[model samples]
Target chain A: MKSLFFRTISVTFFLASFSGAALVDDHIHGGDSHLPRPVVVEYSDVESLASGNDDVRLWCESWRFAGEANNLGPWTTVPVECVSYVKTYMTGKRYAFDLEMVSREASRFARSIQMRTDGMDAWVFDIDETLLSNLPYYAEHKYGLEIFNHGLFDKWVEKAVAPPIESSLKLYEEILGYGFKVFLLTGRSEAHRSITVDNLNRAGFRDWERLILRSLDDRKKSATIYKSEKRDELVGEGYRLHGNSGDQWSDLVGSSTSNRSFKLPNSMYYIP
Target chain B: MKSLFFRTISVTFFLASFSGAALVDDHIHGGDSHLPRPVVVEYSDVESLASGNDDVRLWCESWRFAGEANNLGPWTTVPVECVSYVKTYMTGKRYAFDLEMVSREASRFARSIQMRTDGMDAWVFDIDETLLSNLPYYAEHKYGLEIFNHGLFDKWVEKAVAPPIESSLKLYEEILGYGFKVFLLTGRSEAHRSITVDNLNRAGFRDWERLILRSLDDRKKSATIYKSEKRDELVGEGYRLHGNSGDQWSDLVGSSTSNRSFKLPNSMYYIP
Candidate 1:
C-alpha cells in the first residue's frame, strides 16, 4: 500500500511539473498578491517602455494578456504587441468563437440541471461586455489604443444603442428558456436603469426578472464585494445561483461564486 | 447628487471599456467554473495549431501568459512562446522578486493584525514550490520541458535535498518571530511525513507546529475543497489564519481564504 501510494505522489509530481504555464495564468479575482506590483511609471518611462523592458512587458502583458476582470486604470502607454492582440481579438472571429464556445458550455450546464420551478433557480449576468458589445464604440476610439475617455463613453452609454453580443444573445435566450430566473446585475448606475432597460430590450434581451444596476451606494465597493454581496442577498432569499457569466473577473469571482461560471473573451481592456 | 451619480457610472464605463484582456486570464483556484474551459484540441490539429490560428493562439497564450493556478492536464502542445516563457520565468529573477513583494505585503498584513497572543494566530504554507526549490530537480529534468519522470523525481524527493527559496525563508522566519503558529500543509502523501519533516528541517524550516500531509483517503478531493476544508477545521478551532502563500492557486483560493494571501511565481508548474 505504501509503495503504491508513493507511486501515486510520484505520478502527480510528474504531471504537476509539466503544466507550469498554469502558474503564469494567475487571473486575479481577489488579491492574488503574488505578482510584482505593476510598474505605475510616469510619462518619463514611456519612451524606454516602448523601446524594450521585459519587466514592463511582463507586467503590461500580464495585465493585457492574462485577463483579470476589471475597469481600473491610468494605464501605461500601450505596447506594440497589444495592438496586435487587440486587433486579433476584436477584428477576428476568435472573439466570436470563444463566445459561441461559452454559450454552448452554458447550454450544457443549463441542460444538466433539473430546475426547481420555484422561481428560485437563478442565473446572474453582468452588463457591459458580457451581454452587450461596446465594440463599435471601441473601434472609433482607436481600439482602446488611446487612454479611455470618461465623459465621451458616458455620453455614449446614455445613447442606449449598444448592440447585443451575438453569442451571449443566444445564451441569454437559452437560459431564460431553461426555467431559471434571470437577473441582470450591471455596473451601470441605478439612475440609468430606464435607459439600461430600454437598451437591453432594444438589443434583443428580454424577460429578465430583475435589472439590478448598481446603486449610488455601491460606488466605492469593489466589484467582487459588491456583486458577491448582492448574490448573498439572492441566496438569502432562497435563490440558487446556478449560472454566472461575465467578462470581468469581479463578475464571477469572490464569495457567492456561482455553481457554474462562464467567462467570455474581451482582450482589448481590463476592469478591476 | 443625481448628476454626480451619472458621472460615476460614466467614469466606470471608460475603465470598463479598454481592458478586455481580463477575459484571458482565468486564474483557477480549484475550479472557478466560469473560467472559459481551456480549449482542448485533437492531436490531429497540431499542424493547424502551429500555423496562424487565432483560437489556438488565444487558448495557448492565456494558459502560458496568464497566471492561473493548477496542474491540469491534457494541455495543448505548449506553444513556442510558452517555452520561451518557461525558460525566462524559471531562469530569471522575476520569481524571487515576486516572492519578495508578497513577503513585504504579508509583513504589512501581519503587522496590521492585532493577534490575541493566545498563540493561536497562525499562517499556512504549502510545501514544494512555496518553501522549497524544486529547481535543481527541474534543472536536471529540463525544467519540465520534458515529460516528468515519476520514479526519477521520487528518487530525487527521497534524497531530500531541496533548498529553501530565500525570500520565503525570510518570510517564514519573520512570521515565526511574530509569535504566529506555523503549519506546513503539503499535498505529499502522509506516508512520507518522516522524510518530509527531515527534508524541511534540513532546508531551514524548523519548529513548524504541525506538518499536515494528505492521507490516502484524500485522493478524490480537489485541492481547493480539500485545503479549504482543512482551513475550516482550523477556523472551527478558533485559530485565525492571518496569512497564506503558495506557488499554486489551490494553496490560497476558496472558502476561509486568509486575511492576507500571497502567490509566489512558479510558471514552471501548477497543481490543481
Candidate 2:
C-alpha cells in the first residue's frame, strides 16, 4: 500500500482540472471547511498530453543541465506522461552522449590544473548512477510500475552486482591516473555503507580516499542542502575539490563544488 | 464569474493534498475512470509546509535566482500555506529592500559605464509592477480572494492612474538622465498600447526608446521565450541593452539582458 500511495501516473487527470487552484463552483471553500473537490481535465495539445505539466518539462530540462530533480524513486514513472520521451532518454545513444560529456569534462579538468604540489586534490563521485549503471533495475521495475521496494534495492546493493557505467568509469580511471584523490559521495544512508562499498568494489570502482555517506539526521534535510553541507565539510578539511561527478545537480552546484563538475544521466527516478 | 476562475487564496487546500498529482475522489470521475484515494502527507519541516509542493518552492527559488517558474497565476494562492511567510514577503519593509536593490543597481550601472561612446545603449523594463504600483488594487482584490475581473482591471488600467513605484521611478529617471534609450517590454498585447503609454506617463515614466507590447501570437509563448525573442529583435537592430528592470525575473533574464538587470518586489501576483 505504501507503493500504492504514490501511483498517480497521469498528472493530466489531477493537475489540469485544478491548476491546483481552480476549485469547484465559483468560490474556493475556505481552509476550515473545504471538502476535497474532484478534478476535471481536458487535454488538447499533443506535446502537453505527452507530459504531466510544465514542471515535468522543467525537471527534464534541469536534469539535462544540472542533473537535478526531486529524488522520488526510479521507475516510479507516473508523473512523466510522454512514453517516447523517456524511451529516447533511456536509450544507449543518450548514454553515449552523457559519457561524452564526462570524458570532455575530465579532459577539461585535466588540462586546467597544474597538479597541485602540496594539497590533496579530490574528485567526488555520487555512487548510484555515476559510477554504476542501474538500467537493469529500472528496466525490470519500469517507471510508473510497482512502487520502489527499498528492501529489494538494498538486496541489489548487497549483491554488488551492478555493472560499471562505462563513460563514468572511463572518467573515474582518467582522473585517478592524473594523481587526484577520488572520494565517493552518495545520498544513501550510512547504514548501507558496507554494502555500498562492496557494490562499488564489485562493480570495478577502485577508490583512494573516503566514502562519504549521509547520517540518519542528514536524511531529513533536502538533498541540495544536505549535499551542500557535505561539500562545505570537505572544503573545511582543506581538501581542494577539483572535480566532481554525479547523476544529480545536487552533486554539482553547491557550497563545496569543485572547479568543475560532471553529471551523468538518470531519469528513472527523481530525488529532491 | 469568469474572473472568479482566476482566484484561489489558500495554496494549502489545493497544493498540499494533490501536489497537482493527488486526485479528488468525486469530480475526477467526470474526466475519466479516476479513483479517489485518501491522501497521505507527512510534513517534517516548517519550510516544506510553507508553500504548496516542492515544485512550487522550487519555482519561487528559481524565480528569485534565474527567473524561471511554471506559468502559475499570481493569485493561485491555493497551496502556499504559510500565512506569516507571505505576510512578511509582502511587507513595505521588504519592498524597501527590493527598491534598495534597484537603487543600488541603478547606481552601479551609472558608475560602470563610460557614457557608452559605441552603439545606442538601451534599457528594457516590464510594464506591470515595474514603473507602476498595483498595491492599491490588490489591497482590495487580494490574491486568491476574488476572481480577477478583466473589465475592472481594464478600467483601472484605462484610468492611467497607476502611481509610480518610487524606487523604479528614480531608476527610470536616472537611466534617462544618463542618456540611455529605454524600452518597455511587456507581455500585455498590442491593443493595450495606448492605455499602457498613458499609464506609463501618469506613472511618471517618460522615455526615449519604445514601448514594445506582445502581439496575439506572442502572448502564447512563455515569458522567457517571448522576452528573449524581443531582445533578439532588439539585438538584431544593433541596440546594446545596457540594463533591464522589472518585477518579474523574465524581464531581467534572457537574450540581450543588458550589462545587469534589476528585479523589484511583487509576490502579490506571479506572472508566468
* Weakest ten-residue segment in model 2 chain A by summed lDDT: A22-31
* Regions more than 4 Å wrong, model 2: A1-80, A144-146, B1-272
- Tens digits of lDDT, candidate 1, A128-219: 87888787787777675654455577777889998887667777898988888999887777778888888888989999988887676776
Please give the lDDT score at residue B259 for candidate 1.
70
* CA RMSD (A), model 2: 22.6
* Error at B84, model 1, angstroms: 8.3
Worst lDDT 10-window in candidate 1 chain A: A8-17
TM-score of chain B taken alone, candidate 1: 0.74
Proportion of true inter-chain contacts also present in candidate 2: 0.00
Docking class of 1: incorrect
Q: Model 2, A14-127: lDDT tens per residue?
A: 211111111111110001122234433332311221244454543333322221222111112223343344555555343443444344435545656788876488888887
Q: Interface RMSDs of all predictions?
A: 14.3, 21.2
